[model samples]
Target: MSEPDPGLSSGAVVAEPETLHAPPPRLSSPLARLALDFCASRPAVAGLAVILVVAVAAIFAPLIVPQNPYDLAQLDIMDGTLPPGSPSYAFGTYWLGTDVQGRDMLSAIVYGLRISLLVGSVSVAFALVIGSAVGLVAAFFGGGLDSLLMRIVDIQLSFPAILVALILLAIFGNGVDKVIIALVIVQWAYYARAVRGSALVERRKEYIDAAVCLGLGTRRVLFGHLLPNCLPPLIVIATVQVAHAVALEATLSFLGVGVPITEPSLGLLIANGFEYMMSGRYWISFFPGVALVVVIVAINLVGDRLRDLLNPRLQR
Candidate 1:
């Protein structure tokens, strides 16, 4: 070997990398930072708190609720439409009052909330997975496939999502699964478009070119390299879509096409109470309506914060 020379000197050492190959900051770091920001914002914090409390209540509905609202054996016609704090409530003491079926309003709301959340979350998750995959494939191999997929998205988007959902539900019939399937059909395009847009941008980056040069297979490049980068806006969209889904479910139920009567969602409750509304037995509809509003508003606030944080263009 020739004289090992770095400026003809032997004592030279390279400085440490810009960042050491330290194991990344704990996964919780970003979440903790997000939590801190969330807490600092009053509306966001309040929204998060509401979501947590509602979720907790929904989880513990069977245990905390005095009676199973769905059990006909537990309901008493005599107790029906009792106002809040009525001493003679047949099913027992109820904090929020009783509906026409003598089902505890609070209990029903909790169960309904559970159903609404379950449907919304599961549908969104399903849509996200499928939509992301389609988006990745379309954008990564952008040619006829991209054109076809985007045109389909365009056609889907041109119609009101609710109308399409209504049509799907008509074919699928009424049930929680049907509702979930309908929402997934209506919502997947949004996720696909968002992912495709993000991936289109990501695929052009130099890292992607380098990844391609490394002979990384399409699957690895699509998921291992590209998917992570496309998730920021997708997460924000998910948060907002959850609220939309809940509202949509309620609307469908209100229109008598969503969840079945035996499992009444918030919308069904509102529909049940519509006649009672004129009769002054307002608690049936009023409390559930309030719950729905609170959930939607809270989720929207949180989603707004997420968008502001994730999208630089949306930042002040």
Candidate 2:
């Protein structure tokens, strides 16, 4: 049989040591694969879905809401404080019920989400930009610069974030911009520490040496290579920080320092409803309270998962 057809023989295939010596099929980078795997996982996917729904509702509040909360013409004082399941104020008409100001609670929550999201997103952005820049510079050029930046971070960390926010808000006076300023000031140190730690490690990598050998500019290496690599941790930090920022904004609003009285945020709604709690209008604060709790919990769940996913050491 032609010498047992060596090429087709099982023994011949098994004896090809070269095949075993050949490198295993190239796998994708660990970071990229990890990110893809996390996104594909059920909990992360569901978290994203919930976030999208909330975002869409907030974005299209005007069109989605039955009554415009801000429009004086549409709001009737008679409709104010109507409990759930009331006639004339049907389930569809005042779904979340109305506030003391006669504003649709559903609409108010939608609009409030817009404000909260905006402030939270902007503050996080501000923190990321400022912190990353400081950390990058400090890590790239150690000594005095690192010491100074780290000292600032340490000093800031020494104080409670709320206390710092309170001091800044007190100085700036209460407004949306001022609230954002306070949040940024209070939040950037966390980002700076995270980025600094990441940058320190990335700066020592062989690729960084290769980039330097290629005569690529320092800014290019720091931003293009180092920064991108640092983003995974930063992203995890940002998600958690956003929840904190939202809660901080609510706390400020509750304390009467966040978004003015003219614009009612969720905290303002809760603060206003506090008085009516004893009057048996439980729906006033209860609904908003529930909404806030749900949002914070959802965000925290997502953030915690992301943190674990990104850190292999944390994996069970």
lDDT of each residue in 249-285, candidate 2, tens digit only: 9899999878898775888888989999999987888
RMSD to native for every prediction? 9.5, 4.8
Report the lDDT tens digits of candidate 1 across residue range 152-195.
Answer: 99998899988998998889899999999999989999989999
- lDDT at 123, model 2: 98
Clashes of each: 0, 0
What global local distance difference test value does model 2 have? 0.85
Top of the candidates by TM-score: 1
For candidate 1, the TM-score is 0.88
